[model samples]
Structures are given as C-alpha cells and as structure tokens.
Target: MTDVVGIVIVSHSPLVAEGAADMVRQMVGDRVPLAWCGGVGEGVLGTRLSDIRAAIDRAWSERGVVVMVDLGGAETNSEMAIEALPPERRRKVVVANAPVVEGAVLAATEAASGAALATVLATAEEAGARCRSVPSKTSAGRRQ
Candidate 1:
C-alpha cells in the first residue's frame, strides 16, 4: 500500500479549522489522515503549544504531516511545534502556503508519497493559486 499524506490545520479557532477539514472530507471522502488543532470545539482543542504538539504527534505517526494555519498565532504555534520535534520527526512536517482547504485537498488527491516534500508543496501552491481569493495587490507579495 502507498504511504498516506497527513494533513494538519491549525487555526485560532477550531471551528474554522474543522470547517476546512469538513470541506475536504466532503470533497475527498476522508481517506487521508487529517488533523485539526487550535481553539476548542467539543472536547478537542489545542490553544496551548503542548496541545498543538500532541495533535501533530498524533497525525504524524505513519507518513508525513502537512500543516495549514489560519493566522499568525496558529502559524507561529505550528512552527514552534515542528521546531521542537526531533530532527527525524521534524522532517516529516510541512508548513503550507495558504488556504488550507485547497492545499490539503490537492495534496490528499494526488501521488504525493515516495516523492519529495517540495513536490507536494508545489502541488498545494498550485491548488492555492487556483483558489486565489480575488486577484489583489496582496498576492503580488508572493512574487517578491
């Protein structure tokens, strides 16, 4: 069997992250290991660094982890979690560009295993471009 691609979405609010994950499931049927961390929803919330770390650990057991954050706080926390992991484990984590929904969906729907992380990232970035939130000057920043 092919190795699965793990996806992690961290947001300031778990509701939003869950919503994104739900959208992916709606589209892709949930075969992938998708993990959501951040603010609380039901009983699964990880606002603290430790919570985020645990969530990542849970998601990164089999294959690699693809992380998507909603804002600076979530992004920073995810980054911290990855940095704190052992070098070998840390290699399995990937921080996505933006629009976790699009990125994760594209990653989950492709030939990602046995390939370089860069290839997966490229696929995600392309997916994000396809779902670009209205052409704006802000997008220009990406060129720089």
Candidate 2:
C-alpha cells in the first residue's frame, strides 16, 4: 500500500487549519490520511496540544506526519507537542517548512513512501510562494 501522508496545520485561528483541510478535500479528496491541529471552533480540527501530538503519533505509526504552522505561537505549540513524543516518534514527526496552508498541501501531495520530511517541506515552501503569486478573481467578474 502507498504510505499515508499525515498533515497538521497550526494557526492563530483554528478555522485556518480546518479550512486548509476543507480545501484539500475539495482538491484531492480524503483518500490520503490527513489531520489538523489548533483552531477556536468547536468541531474544528484538534484543539489541544495532546490531541495534536496524538494525531501525529497515530498518523506516523501508520506512515508518517508533517506539521505546518501559520505563525510563531502555533509553531511553538506544535513544536512542543512533537518534542514531547518519544524519540522514535520524533523521527516520524516533521516540522514542515513554512508550515502554512499552501505548503502543507504541496508537501503532503508530493510526498511518496517514506520520503524525507525535509524534502516534502521544501516543496511545500516553494508551492506556497507559487500559490501566493496567483491572482484572485475580482467582484466585477461575477454578478452578485
């Protein structure tokens, strides 16, 4: 079986993490294993540090996991969670490059079986930059 790619998005708002998952679902469907962390909403992604860490462990146990954070605070929490895991688990847990929405998707998608987390993270960073370059549609384009 193809190795699963675990994902975690940490942001100031949990919605951002959840939204990333929603977008991924729309683009790639849920065939690949995915997870989320951080968010203020009730049902939005894993909230507590322990939950995030557990998800990472679970995902990694199945295959491996990549964690992406939107900002310093989120990154700190995510990092702490990962650090708290057992040494063996740390090998499976990756602190993703630029840990943003765009990066997470790109990394997760590009990652094949047992690929190094750093490689996927690099792809994510590059993809995020590319995504930023895309122009958004203006209100004038559609009748509202």
lDDT of each: 0.67, 0.63
Off-target runs (Cα >4 Å) in candidate 2 are: 40-47, 112-116, 128-144
lDDT of 1 by residue, 26-144 (tens): 87765666777667446554455776788787666456777876555566677888999999988888787756666767766652344445666677778767667743113222110
Query: What's model 2's lDDT at 22?
Result: 77
Clashes of each: 0, 1
Q: Report the poorest 10 consecutive residues by lDDT, candidate 1.
A: 135-144
Alpha-carbon shift of residue 105 in model 2 (angstroms): 1.7
Candidate 2 — which pairs collide?
Answer: 14-39
Model 2 C-alpha lDDT per residue in residues 1-144, reported as the tens digit of each score = 236666766655667777887776677666556776565456443346776776565445345677776655566667788889888777777776453767766766766434555666677777656655543212232111
